[model samples]
Structures are given as C-alpha cells and as structure tokens.
Target: MSKTWFITGASKGFGREWAEAALERGDNVAGTARNLDDVQELVDSHPDTFLPLQLDVTDRSADIDAVRKAHEKFGVLDVVVNNAGFGHFGMVEELTEDEVRAQLETNFFGALWVTQAALPIMREQGSGHIIQVSSIGGISAFPTVGAYHASKWALEGLSQSLSQEVAGFGIHVTLIEPGGYSTDWSGPSAKRSDEIDAYSAVREEAAKRPSANDPGKPEATRSAILKVVDAENPPLRIFFGKAPLGIAERDYESRLQTWREWQPVSEEAHGS
Candidate 1:
C-alpha cells in the first residue's frame, strides 16, 4: 500500500527533499508552495504521483482547502509534513512587533492551522502521521535566532500535546529537530532585523556562523524523516544532528540543577 503525503513548502529546502524522497519510494505526494511554478519541474517529471498546490500556510482557509484537496485526490493522507516556515534572525529587543507576529503566524500558527485541518480526516481513517519540522532551537536557544527559536518552541509544545491527544487514533507526531543544514533557512528565506548598535557584538558572532551554504545536507534530514514514517512505532521526538542532542542535554541539565536548588521553595506553592 503506497502512502500519500501532503508536504508544505515543497518548492525548496527540506520540503523539496521530502517530496522527492516520497515520490522515489513510490508514494503519492501533494506539495504546497506559495508559487506553483517553483515546483513545476517536479510536477512535470512526476505527473502521476505529484500534485503541486499553491498555498500560503499562514492562511487558515488556504491550509484547509489544500489538505482537503490532497485528501480528495489521494483518498487518504498517510503523512502530513508541516515544513513551510522561514527563519527570523534578531535579538528580542531588535525585532519589531510586526516581525514577531509574522514569525509566530507562519512558524507556529501556520502549522497549527494545517494540523487542525488534517486531524478530522486522519481521525476518521484511524491512522496517520503528522511530522512537524521543528529546529534544534526548539529545545535550546541561541543569540540571534531568538525569534525563530520562539516560534519552534511553541510548535514543539503544540506537537507534544497533539501527540498524546491523537495517539488513540493512531496519528503519531514526530518533531524533526535538526541542526543547521544546507537549506534556504539561513539564506534568502531568513528575515533579518534592523541594526541595533547595542546588540552588534552578538549579531556579528551569529553572522559568522554557517548558513544554508554549510557542508551539511538537507537530504540527510529527508532520509531520517523517511525512516520515521516507515517505522511502526516512531519516536515522538527524533533528532537529526548531534548538535541538537548536545543543546537539549545541556539545557535540561542546567534546568534540573536549578530545579533541585529551588525544590523547597517550589514545593511551597503546591498543596500538601
């Protein structure tokens, strides 16, 4: 039984890789990109197995329509990959209100809208997989990518709760926490905040870090995703790079240390 997939941001980056991986494996795919022409080559090459949809994931109505159309075309959606999101680079103080809203709207709320649209269909089918492309920052924060981290953190929380809620329906959720890869994420797709003199040191350091031009490959992440989709019981959280694991462990360890130190004071607020 060939699976059907709905992948957001299919025009490029990890989304494009995921779509190719699925099609190569003989699965049907409906991919959403803001510009249909961005994926015309894919549509032309895989006419029988690929459907390219024009979508802006932040638009709730468009998301619902896209999911419904995919379901109608494929009969069922075995996997729905929410991979449409851009990175916002800035310190908390440097970002404008609009920038903050845009980050949350696309990265957090956009995934929320698409997932909400897919839930009922998957529930009725009694089985499905929802893959959220969260970042390593979802578990730990860095200096300049604060806004991006905030968005992914919210997504992680949403997917965490969603997994528990949908487990009975056999709709498993996997959060793809990968470190920086060679993707447009830190390049053209990434938005930058205006200069603020006080944060210059931190911003300069961030700029020195590798971007999408790094040696790492997005294809590797795509391969990891395929492995998760094929597994009978996929982990709720799967990591792509050792960097993400290192960040998570360090963050958790530090938090635990603080928690232990505060135990007596923290327990005072709870009922005996």
Candidate 2:
C-alpha cells in the first residue's frame, strides 16, 4: 500500500532524505518548507507524487491549513513528520527572552499545533503515524545549548503523553531523537546568542564534546526512518545514530543513581 506523508522542514536534512525515500518507493508526499522554492526540486523530480508546500510551522493556523491541503491532495495522511525546528545555541543565562520564546514557539508549540491538526484526520481514518524529530538533547542536558535542550525536552514529554492518548484511536506517535548529524542545524540554520566572557570556558568544553566533532551522516538515516514508518508496531522513541545509545545509557544511569540517593528524602516529603 502506498502511504501519504506530510513532512515539515522538507527542504533539507532528515526530512528531505525521508521524503525522497518515500517518494522513491512510490509513496505520496506533501513536503513543506518556509520557502517553496527550497523544496521545488522534489516537485520537479516526483511530479506525480510530490506536493511542495510553503509553511512556517510556528503559525498555528498555517499548520492547520497545510495539513488540510495535504489531505485534500492525497486523500489520506499515513505519516506526518514534525521536523520544522532549529537549534538555539547558548547557556541558560546567556539566552534572551526573545530567543527562548522563539525556540519554544517553533520546536515545541509548532509540533503541538501540527499534532492537534492531524489528530482528527488520523482518528477519522483510524490509522496514522506522527513522527516528531527531536534530538539527543531531548534526553540529556548539556552546556552552551540549554535553550535547544529545553525545546527538545519539551517535545519528548509532549510526545510521550500524546502516545498514550492516541493509542486507542490507532494513531502512533514516535519521537526521532537523533544524535548530532552533519546537517545545517548547527550552521547557517542555527541561532547563536551573544558570547559571554564568563561562559567562554564552558563553550570551549562543549566544543570538545564528541558530538561536536563527530556527527553522523544524515543520508545514513534514510533506511532507519523508512523502517520505522513501515513497522506494524513502531517504537515510541527511536534514536537515529550510534552515539545516542551510549549517551543515553550513561545519562540514565546517573539519573537513576541520583533518584535512588534521594529516594529517602522523596518518601519523607510525601508523609503527613
């Protein structure tokens, strides 16, 4: 069966790769970008199966309209990928009100709006998949990118709750928590806060992290995404690269240790 996909941020990175993979497999895709010209190639290449849409996911109404357009064109939306977000690099203190708001508006609220818009359609069909493109930052916190971490972490929690809520409706929600990938996410597409002298050392240390130097190839994720969307029962969350597993293991172990250490205090606090 040919599936129809509505992918945001389809102009580049994982979204573009996944869109291409689906279209190549004879599936229909309504791929969106802020500038339709950025994704026009998909339309040119897969004329019959591709629909390019210009969208700013942060706009709630725009997201709803885009979803409606996709359903109108394809008649069904088997997959919806919320990949329209960018990274904001800065320490928590270095982040400004505007920067933090912008990050959440797009990374968190944008995905929320899209999910809200797609739910009714999916519930009507009684079958659909929602893929939220999160990051390793969604699970673990690191310095210098606190704002970015906050946004992804919000998504992680939102999707976790969404999975349970939509299960009865036959809708699946998966958060794609990818490790660092060689995408423009950290380049031209990223927003950087003003450098602070006090945070210089922290920035230097962050730059030395393995993820900063070693990033997975975005193209390598194509097969994994295809498998995930095709699975009869997909994972609620899946990491796209090798690095995330180890990082998650270490982070989880530390978190468990801290929770165990504080278990006595937690139980005591609950008492009358």
Candidate 3:
C-alpha cells in the first residue's frame, strides 16, 4: 500500500530529501515550507504525489489545520515527519531572551504542537508512524548550540514517552538522531549570539564545526540517510556521522556507568 506522509520544513534539508524519497516510492506527500512557493517546482513536477503546504509549525492552530488538510487531501496519514527546526549557535549566557524563545518555538514547541495535532488522527485510524528528525545533540550536548540541543533533547524525551503511550494503538515513533547532513541546516542556520565577544573562543570553535546546513561531511550524511532509510526496525535513537558514533558512544557508556554507580544510593532512597 502507498503510504501518505506529511513533513514540515520541507523546502530543504532532511525533510525535502525524505519527501522526495517517499514520492519516488509512489507514496503520497504533503510537504510544508513557511513559503509554499519554495517547493512549487517539486509540487508541480509531482502533482499526483506531492502537495505543498505553506505553514509555520510554531503556529499551533496553523499546524492543526495543515494536518487536517493533509488528511483531507490524501484520505490517510501513515507518517508525520517533524522536520522543522533551526539551530542557535551560541552559549546560553550570550543569547537573548527573544533568541531563546525563537529557538524553542520552532525546534521544540513546534514539534510538540504538530505531534499533538497529528496523534489523535493517527489513533483514530489505528495505525501511524511519527518520525522526529532530531540531531546527535538531541542526546548529547556539546560546547555551543546549547539552546538548540535543549529543544532537541526535549523533543527526544517527549517522543520517547510518546512511543510507549502510542504503541498500544499501533503507532510507532522513530527519533532520528542525525549527526550532520548536507542540507541548509548549517550555513543558513548558524545564528550568531549578540554577545559573541563575551565567548569568542567557544563561539568561534563552534562555528568551525559542520552543521546540517553546511555539513563538512557529505559522505557521512549520505551514508546515514541510506542506513536509516533501509533499517527494518530502526531504533528509537540513531547516531549518524563519523564523529557522533565515537563521541555519543562514549557518552552513552559513561552515562550508563554513572547510573550503575548511583543505583545503590537511588535504591536506598526508594526504600528498596
């Protein structure tokens, strides 16, 4: 059966690629960019398969409407890909209140609102998949991109809980932890903190690191996409890129060890 997929931030990055991949497989898609015109060419070429929606997921009501419209257009929603997000490359202290809010609005709350809107429909249908395009930072925090990572980490936590909640309804969730991709996720995404001078060394080093937009590693992105898209039962957490594996692995192992070390104390507190 041909799946019907709806993706946000679909003009570029992993969202665009995922939509194209789905369309190539004869699936139906309703892809949204803040400006639908950005994807007009794609929609024009695949009129039968692609429906472009103009929306900003941060707008809770708009997101709900888009999901409803997508369902009406396709008659079913098999997958909802939460791919709309941006990064704020700066230290917590260097960022402004507005910048922090903007990052959370798009990266975290946007996903939350859309997922809430999509879930009931999926539950009613009795089958669906929610794909969250989170980053390696979703699980592991680094030097910069603190706010960005917080948003993703929150999404990861929300999705993790959601996975368990919806499993009984035949709804599965895939939290895609892509390290870096050859998408406009970096150069275009790299936002400067107003207080850059206050944290110059860390900020400069962070800028040097590749992002999803200006990924220094195209091969890594390609490899990750291929692997992730082909997995039979893809994990709840997936780490992409040459660097993420080693770094995330070490972090994961260390966390586990730390947890084990703390278990005795935790058990005593719980009266176990």
Candidate 4:
C-alpha cells in the first residue's frame, strides 16, 4: 500500500532525504519548507507524488493550515514527521530569554501544534504515525547546548505521554532520537548564544567529547525511517544512529544508581 506523508523541514537534512526516499518508493508526500524554492526539486522530480508547502512550523496557525492542505491534497496522512528544528548552542547562563523561547517555540511547541492538528484527522481515520525528530541530546544533556537540551527533553516527555494518549485511537507516536548526523544542524542552521568567559573551559571540554566529531551520514538514515514508518508495530522510541545506544546505556545506568542510592530519602520524604 502506498502511504502518504506530511513532513516539515523538507528542504534539507533528514527531512529532505526521507521525503525523497518515500516519494521514490511511490508514496505520496506533502513536504513543507519555509521556502518553497528549497523543495522545488522534489516537485520537479516527483511531480505526481509531491506537494511542496511553504511553512514556518513555529506559527500555530501555519502548522494547522499546512496539515489541512496536506490532508486535502493526499486524502490521508499516514505519516507525519515533525522535522523542522534548529540546534541552539550555549551554556544555560549564556542563553538569553529570547533564545530560550525561540528554541522551545520551534523545537517543542512547533511539534506540539502539528501533532494537535494531525490528531483529529488521524483519529477520524483511526490510524496514523507521528514521528518526532528529537535528538540523542533529548535523552542525555551536555554542557554547552543546555537550551537545545531543554527543548528536546521537553519533547521526549511530551511524546512519551502522547504515545499513551493516542494508542487507543490506533495512532502510533514515535520519537526519532537520532545521534549526531552530518547535517547542517550544527553548521549554518545552528543558533548560538553569546559566549561567557566562565563557560569557555566548559565549551572546550564539550568539544573534546568522543562523539563530537563522529556524525553519521544523513543518507544512511532513510532506510531506517522507512522501516520504522512501515512497521506493523512501530517502536515508541528508536535511535537513528550508533551513538545513542551507548549514551542511553551509560546515562540510564548512572540515573538508576542515583535513584537507588537515594531511595530511602525519597521514601522517607513520602512518609507522614
């Protein structure tokens, strides 16, 4: 069966790759970018199967309208990928109010609005897959990108709850927690806060981390995404690259150890 996909940030990175892969496999795709020109080639290459939409996902109205337009064109939205977000780089103290809000507006709220817009349609159809393009940072935090971490972490919690809420309706929610990818996420597309002198050493330390330079190829993820969306029972959360498993294993072990160490205190606090 040919599926229909509505993908945000379809201009580049994983969005573009996934959109192209889907269209190539004869699925219908309504792909959105802030500028239609960015996705013009998709339309040119797959005229019958591609609909390019101009969208800024941060705007709630825009998100709703884009979803409506996609459903109107495709008749069904089998997969909805919220892939429009940029990385913000800074220490917590170096982040400005505007930067923090902007990060949340696009990374967290944008996905939320799109999910809200798509839910009614999916509920009506009684089936759909919602893919939230989160990051390894969503699970494990680092020093310099605190604001970015906050946004993805918020998304992680939101999607976990959403998975439970929408399961009865035959809708599936999956968080795509990708490790570092060779995308422009940390290049031109990244937003950076003003650096503070105190955090310079912290930034240097972050740069030396083992995963800092080892990014998976963006093209390598297309097959994984296709498999995920097509699965009879998709995972609630899946990692797109090699690095996230190790990170999760190490982080969760530490977290579990801490909780166990503090279990008595936690139980004591609950007592009368």
Number of the top candidate by lDDT? 4
Clash count for each candidate, listed in order shown: 0, 0, 4, 0
User: What digit string (tens of lDDT, one per residue) describes model 2 on residues 123-205?
Assistant: 99999999999998999988888888889999999999999999999999999999989999989999999988998888888
With a 3 Å backbone cut-off (N, CA, C), the pairs that clash in candidate 4 are none
Question: lDDT per residue, candidate 4, 1-272, as tens digits?
Answer: 99999999999999999999999999999999998999989999999899999999999998999999999998998999999999999889888999999999999999999999999999999999999999999999988888999999999999999999999999999999999888999899999988899878888988887765788999999899999999999999899888899999999999999999999999999997
Tell me which of candidates 3 and 4 scores higher on TM-score.
4
Candidate 3 stretches greater than 4 Å from native: 207-234, 257-272
Q: How close is candidate 4 to the true structure, as a TM-score?
A: 0.98
lDDT of 1 by residue, 124-216 (tens): 999999999998888888798888989999999999999999999989999998887867787899999987899888877876654333446
Off by over 4 Å in 4: none
Where's the lowest-lDDT run of ten residues in candidate 3? 212-221
How far in Å is the alpha carbon of 37 misplaced in model 3?
A: 1.3
TM-score of each: 0.95, 0.98, 0.88, 0.98
